[model samples]
Target: PKSTPAPDRHRPSSAPPAAPAAARVLWKRGDTGRDVRELQARLRQVEWLVDGPTGTYDDLTERAVSGFQGKRGLPRTGRTDTVTWQRLLGMSHEPGKWDLYLMGGQPAAAPDLRCTSGRVLCVSKSSRTLRWMIDGRTVSTMSVRFGSQYTPTREGVFQVYWKSRHHVSTLYDSAMPYAMFFSGGQAVHYSYDFAARGYAGASHGCVNVRDEAAIADLYAQVKTGD
Candidate 1:
């Protein structure tokens, strides 16, 4: 007896759809961007990198990232991947401009005619650096901070009128160690605030040096009226 066979129903496929893949981040050496700068900055905070948050994934940055990965039990690939970045983000604080360039990496301007002549504590506002020049030769340099717009740092050559190794600002009541008085209360001195805050803060119309040891040495070398 031939009953019309019912058409076979099509079965639904049993295989499930593939899951969406996670995003990936991979920055190897030779990469250049703000992201690399951030990577370097974080590494600097952890003391894994030095020299720069120069915004380039240089060899140092590669080494630093690799070292950090190894320290955290990750593979030492020397390439900054998403996992490495995530771990670093967890470990480090976001960096400020000064944190990225703690030493004020601005290039030094050409020496002033005065600076090239003889011994001079040549200060450059544009570069934010102070160079101790001897007979036109730069012996040492350090990062410096100046007064703000309200109390602008004076421009023009000045001589060290007085030298006080342990001077305190009588007006402000702050310690002004290695204070080399030049004009009024505007002196080149070691500023704890400058050391800690970098260019974030300003002096009360004084030139502030961050490195205490360098200032001390400069204090010894500099004399009155010179």
Candidate 2:
């Protein structure tokens, strides 16, 4: 009898089976429910759902979804699929019932203690709002965005050190119109991406104001060393 063949040491062991993909409920036009409402709310947070969450997946919702997918290099199906939902969720906060349904009135967030003073740009990450305050009175307030975890917006008291109209970031190659620099490279500026994508995206290390009119007004009022 022939001797048994030696074990092949160079042979690779069998790999483990791939994990199954999570089963996700696909949402398309005409879909209506809490889930759809949540999706709409998340989209609104990112500024995609400009009209707010309607619970029903209508034409507007479909368009918003398609736009978002296109921007993110998704399938552009204009429908909520697993990949789309996951990407949206990662960039957005959990949708509260009020955020989803708009059943309750939205109240203005109280200014931070540090913001109660002379002319100041009161940026509140908690409420995602920025209040232009003068003598402790709010001149104007608008929705704002902050940088991501890797490039967080600096907190605490800071004065406007510089002002630039129609500025662009040399580091990131992004437009930063109406920029009021407070802390180093970080500034309070108008972000077109924020207006377009909403909370779905973040800045490098700046306070992003979405309302162009509000930022323009603020920029006009703000002075260097203010």
Candidate 3:
């Protein structure tokens, strides 16, 4: 007996079964959990998910995510994938309950100290707010927009050198109501586009006020010098 054909080296042995691969959970509409809640909270900080952190991904969240993805040149999948989550995380701050729910009133931001003297149209880029101040006292506040990266609004001290109640831009051929000229072509003016689109649009090197009534009142109060 050929000694027991040398123990077969190629024969398969019965081994314990391998574990199945874990399934990945892609956060999408209708998915509910802490992850979805966190996604909503982050979206809100960037002004995308205006109504939630509802803890469940819904139609509104999908639309908001799609819009955000479109703006950032990402594929408009509306679903939160790894790439989307990373992008959103990079752009937003850790969300607070107030931010997630938009509870309470608009949070107040400290006025820039440089704007604490005399009559000033104190615009803060960080806060995206305009504070109408007189002698260090804030008389009024309103939402405002600034130029895009290509035509950034000039910062630092500026003065109102001209005023035009119904000014139309000769360059861009756009109407700039209640225009108060400051740095070069930049002015504080009412932007109909801002009113309609909210923060979805940008101004052309100008401080754009969405509230027409507020800007009109401000235009009247502000003199050519201040």
lDDT: which candidate is best?
1
Model 3, residue 103: C-alpha shift (Å): 15
Instruction: Give me candidate 2's TM-score against the actual structure.
Output: 0.60
Better by lDDT, candidate 3 or 2:
2
lDDT per residue for candidate 3 within 19-132, as digits (tens), equals 965433379888986677778878877888666455779999999988998998978888877777888999988876434432212345898898898999998877778999
Inter-residue clash pairs, candidate 1: none
The numbered model that scores best in TM-score is 1
The CA lDDT at 164 in model 3 is 95
Clashing pairs in 3: none
Candidate 2 backbone collisions, by pair: 46-197, 46-198, 46-199, 46-200, 47-198
Once all C-alphas are superposed, what RMSD does model 1 give against the true structure?
7.3
Evaluate all candidate structures by whole-model CA lDDT and list the values in order: 0.85, 0.83, 0.82
- Tell me the spans in candidate 1 whose CA falls farther than 4 Å from its real position: 1-35, 38-103
lDDT of 1 by residue, 12-125 (tens): 567898896653657898998777777887998898986657778988998898899899998888998888888989998989766666556656778789898767889988
Give Cα distance to truth, residue 89, candidate 2, Å. Answer: 16
